[model samples]
Structures are given as C-alpha cells and as structure tokens.
Target: MPLSAGPHVVVLVEGRSDAAAVAVLLRAHGLDGEGRVKVVSMEGVTNVARDLRKSRDEHPDAMVLGLYDVAEERFVLGALRRAGVPLEAPVDLVDHGFFVCDSDLEDELIRAVGTAVVEDALDEMGHLERFRTFQYQPEWRHRSLTDQLHRFAGSGSGRKVALAERLAVRLDATTTPPPLAGLLGRIAQHLHP
Candidate 1:
C-alpha cells in the first residue's frame, strides 16, 4: 500500500526478537517509535533485497534503516545496492542508517548489559532458575555464561523476543547496545530534521 504523506522511518529487522528489541529500546530512549517509526521484522536477512524494494515502492518518501547481524553484512550490502542505494563500502552502512549487531541482536544485548544485568532481567522474568537449569544441561555445561545465556534465550517458544524486550527494559538509554542505540538515534534525528 502507499505510505501516508509526510515523514516516516522504517526500521527493518531480521526477526521478531530484533523487532521487539528495537521497539523496546526506542521507548527506553524516550522516543515514541510507534508514532513515526515502524519496526518491521523481515523474517530473514536474505529477504532484505526484496523488502527494500517493496518498502521503496510503497513508501517512496520514508526513510529506511535496518539492523542486521555482523555476519550478514554481505547480504545487507547487496540488498542496499539492489535497492539503488549507492555505497562505497560496508563502512558506509551507518551513513545510510543501517546498523550491525556484533554477531546478532541477542549477543549485542548480552554483552552490552553484561552478565549480572542479564541475570537480573532473567530473574525478574522468573527465568533465572530455568536458565540455571539450562546451563547445567549436558551440552551447555561447558559453554561460557554468555553462550549459555544466548542459547537459552532462544531455546523456548517466544523466549527470544521475551528476553529481548526484558533486556531492553532493564537497560538505561546511556548503556544501550551501540547498534540498537545508533538505530534509535538515527531515527530521532531523521524525524526531527
């Protein structure tokens, strides 16, 4: 469908977890993301090219940004190229508003907030005991705390998004993961400028 007239920003994310994380972080940063910014889950990074094309056609005047795993840089760069966004190299991604999570959004959040903060969020959600149990599982026993937490966050149904939102809620805007924070900053700046 056609976009409504005037300014809007579209934040394309890889999945529900990223979508939930972005929306929560924007609010945490005191932005009404739901107002002029829309967080869309593209389902998979490979589909970025298609979605970019569609968003361009449908919202020709809207600013488009995205968050992707660092591992998916090639796909994002290719998508941008296909969608007619000129880029000299991968480093220009942010100049065009895209941000890269360290490995993935979950990993970024886990590292940004640190072990204790993440544990506290898990505890607040009543999942700390379950997480402890997960760590003791045979395959997870030898993993690092970060690895265990990352995997545990995605292990259960709806758990990934739930954990993402919880982690974002627990984070102060100043301490937000850079990629997520950058996305919010770009959105706010674009909307106001």
Candidate 2:
C-alpha cells in the first residue's frame, strides 16, 4: 500500500504548508489516502512546471492534481500546458483537477475561517500576543487584520502548517476552504472510482 507501490494520486503543492493543510484536511475528512494519495511539495511555485513534468514521468498512471496561489497561476498553467493538458483559461484548472487559491492557501483559510477565529486559534497555541506584536510592526500596522494574519501565518511554514492543521480540524463542511475541500472531494473520487 505504499504510495509508490500502487495506484495513487499525486498532488503537487507550492510548499510544505500547502502540503500540511491538505494532508490534515484529508485525514479529517476520513479520506485515508496516505498510501494511495501523495502530496508532493515542490517547495516553491517556480518549480511547478518542472515538478509537474517529473511527477507525470514518474507516475504516469497516477492522477496528478495541484493547488497553487493566484499570484503563481501563470506558473501552474504554464506547467499544465507543458504537461500536455489542454488548458484554455484559469477556470479550466478545476476541470483538470487543479485548484487555485485567491492569494494562497493561508489567505483562503483565513478568509474562510475568519480573522477572529484564527486569532483565537493563535491564542490557544500561546502565540496570540506574539501575533499582536507582529501586527504592530510598521509595515503591517495599517493593513486589515486579515491581511496581517495572512502575513503572520506566511512568515513561517511551521506556524502556517500548524495553524492550517488546527484550523482544518475545526472546520466543518461549511467552513472548509473551497480549494482544499474541492481537492479532498477529488481525492475521494479518485480513490473510490
């Protein structure tokens, strides 16, 4: 049942945080794709094109899915094209089993779960006051609290990944971020089909 030993789905994500977020959600949903679904972190969006190619080459029979930031859509789309997917536009991503985050996964979760909920989660993690300090920085002081939260979470994948797991655990069907939720559903279909 190892990922490399059977039929599986290969997920290409931008970073560990993206990987962490999706993995946590998948488990929470009881998808149990550990052996059949692999989440591959390319570590950066810039590597999408190359990573996509490599993944397909390595697992030609596996379904390849991806989650990418809006700012990095070009890279994902370019990668899809290079992979021989007939993508006509960004919306076409979902049809190909890829999803785009508005800005990034952090932003999508923050917006879906809310700034206050995230702050509460930070408080539970004993990092609320520290996040308060982060918010007071000159560069972030004037931004919206949600924007500050995104920046704070994006500061490190450690925090981002931890928060993603925490938030996803608290997320019910109504609160799950569209991309993450959609990705989970896709994973389910792939495994069950």
Candidate 3:
C-alpha cells in the first residue's frame, strides 16, 4: 500500500510484529497515529539504511524514528550515520530518534511480562501445551525458559506476529517494556512537542 501523505512522522520498525506491537501500544497510550504517524516495517533489520533513505527521500519534512533489535545495533548505527543522523553508538542513536530492543521485541516482551504470564497468554491461545512439548525436546531442554519461549514463538510462521499482537494487547500501559515505552514516548514527544 502507498504511504499516507503530509506532515506525518515515520516509525521504521524491523518487521510486522514490531509494527503491530508499536501500533497497539501507541493506541493504548492514546496516541492516534493512523494518519499522523506511519509505522513502517522495513521487513528486516538489514533494510534499515535503505528504508531510512527512502522515507527521507519521499517525505523530506517528516520526522523519522527507528526501532531495532539490540543485536542489530551496529547496522542501525551505520544506517543512521549514512542517513546523516549523527551517532557514535546504540545509546547515542536513541537521541537521534532510534531505539534498540534488548535482544529483540520478543525478548523485551517476554522479559516485561515474565515467562509465566507469557505462558498464560500461550495457554489462552491454546498453544501452551505445544510450547511445553517443544520445551522438553533434548535440544531445548537445557535452554533458559525465556530463550525457549523466544525460539518457540518464532519457530512457526506467523507465530511471532500473532504473539506480538496478542502480547502488546495484553500489556499494561504503565508497565510496558523500557524500549517500547521509550519509543512511544519519543514518538509522542515528536508528534506533540
């Protein structure tokens, strides 16, 4: 679909899951971004530079912010640098309108709500038993619960996006994970301040 027009800020996320999570959180916090803010998932972390450049080229006056996984911080930093957003490190990039997820959005959400709660969420989705079965496999037996959960969430196609949407909907606004909260706050500040 073609992007909406006029003075809208663009929030470049790594994928649809992040986009959905961000969208839900923004609405939860009372920020109506349907037309004023564009949450575009670049499809992958590797596309950060290209996406940023494209957004800038298409919407020169629109403010741009980025959300990425911590593991891809270097790529984000390089993208920001190439886009002329001055920064020396991941933390520095935040002030330049880029936020890094700890490990990834799934990791952040899992940590924010805790594994038990996530399991409860999975149970609600009728996948908790399946997840448990996956967890008991020899290869996953020694992994941390969080790691196992993360892996399970991504193992099936569309699972990550579904979980992200459901989890974001389930999250309490006041207790949102730092990276998400910070990204929303930055978007709010940019749009309202």
Candidate 4:
C-alpha cells in the first residue's frame, strides 16, 4: 500500500479504554482525533503486534501510530522493527509509540483530569476502597487517587466524558478531546503542511 497524500493518523491501542483516553486527550488538545485517530484495539497483547503489522502493510505509506503500555513496549516495538518499520525515518512504515504506567492510558488521563474529581467519582462508583488499595500498592501509591480515578474513568469515551462532565459540575474547565481535531491537524502537519 503506497502512502497517500491525505490527512489521517490511525492510532491503534490495546483496548477500548486506551482508545477512550486518547480520544479525550485529542478533544482536550483541540485535536479532532475521533475520525483521524482510528482506534483498533485488541483483546490482549498477543494480537497487538499482529494488528499493527497488518495495518502497516495495508497502509505502507501512511503514518500509523501504535500506543500501548510500557510493559509490552519492548515486545511491540521489536515486532514493528522486525516488520521493517523504520523508527528513525521521517515518514516510515509505522510510528512506533508507547506509554509508561501501571496501566497503559490511565496515567495520561490522571495527569489531564486532576485528583479531587477522581476521588469523588470513584466514591460515586463505589470503588473507594479498591482505589485506596491501589494508592498503597507501591507503584500506584505515589499517584494521587484522583488521577487514578481519571485513568479508571478513561476506560471508555462514554465513561470518561460522563466522569469529566460530573467533575466539571463540581468545578469548571475540565476540557476534553473534541473528537478528531488536533490529532488530524497534527498528522496533516506531519504528512503535508
């Protein structure tokens, strides 16, 4: 598949939750990512590398970005590399990407949504005790409960937005991704200009 001269940045994730977080981030960043950043998530890591490889082959010239957890980063990146993905190239076969966190897209959501709202939301959802457990679990201990709640909320766009809106009700300015605006624009900048 030859690269096309269009504006589309496909974002492959590990699950629907990750897709939702990226979707909201795109909205918050004023990037319309819903359309451009196509979220093709799998049930587990086994199919991630495979799916990415297939997408890359299908869109050889397009900028296909894969975002997932750091735990599987090494494996995914290695898979892409083995599939002839040129990480250093300006517009290579695939834009190999990943994030570091206990949960894949949770950290980003926590960072974006803040703490108080998260705690309240989790309390509303009746997960306060489990949330506290996550807080004391060493790795999750350092991060604020609110942020952890944001990550949990970000499991899906419907859930994430509902949580955001609820939080917004309490405070204000809980900005979210406006579908596929900024992400498409950014991809355009990278591919075109």
User: Which candidate has the highest TM-score of all?
Assistant: 1
Q: Write the per-residue lDDT of candidate 4 for residues 91-159, one digit (tens) a residue.
A: 322233433334444444444456755676768866667667766877666775555565556544466
Candidate 1 lDDT over 1-193, as tens digits, reads: 5546643887899999999988887776666644677777999999899888887777788889999999999999999887777787435688888899989999988988898988888898889999998899999899899999999999889989988998888777667888887888888787666
Residues 1-193, candidate 2, lDDT per residue (tens digit)? 5334654888999998888888887787777644677789999999998888888888888889999988888787787788777876435788988898998888888888898899999998888998999989999999999989888886854888889877777788998888888898898887876
TM-score of each: 0.91, 0.90, 0.91, 0.57
> What TM-score does prediction 1 earn?
0.91
Cα miss at 131, model 4 (Å)?
A: 7.1
Against the hidden true structure, what lDDT does model 4 obtain? 0.55
RMSD of each: 2.8, 2.6, 3.4, 6.8
Q: Once superposed on the true structure, which residue ranges of model 3 sit more than 4 Å away at CA?
A: 1-7, 88-91
Each candidate's lDDT (Cα)? 0.85, 0.84, 0.84, 0.55
Higher-TM-score candidate among 2 and 4? 2
Ranking by lDDT: 1, 3, 2, 4
Q: How good is model 3 by TM-score?
A: 0.91
**TM-score: the better of candidates 3 and 4:** 3
Give the runs in model 1 whose Cα sits over 4 Å from its true position.
1-7
Candidate 2 regions with alpha-carbon error over 4 angstroms: 1-4, 89-91
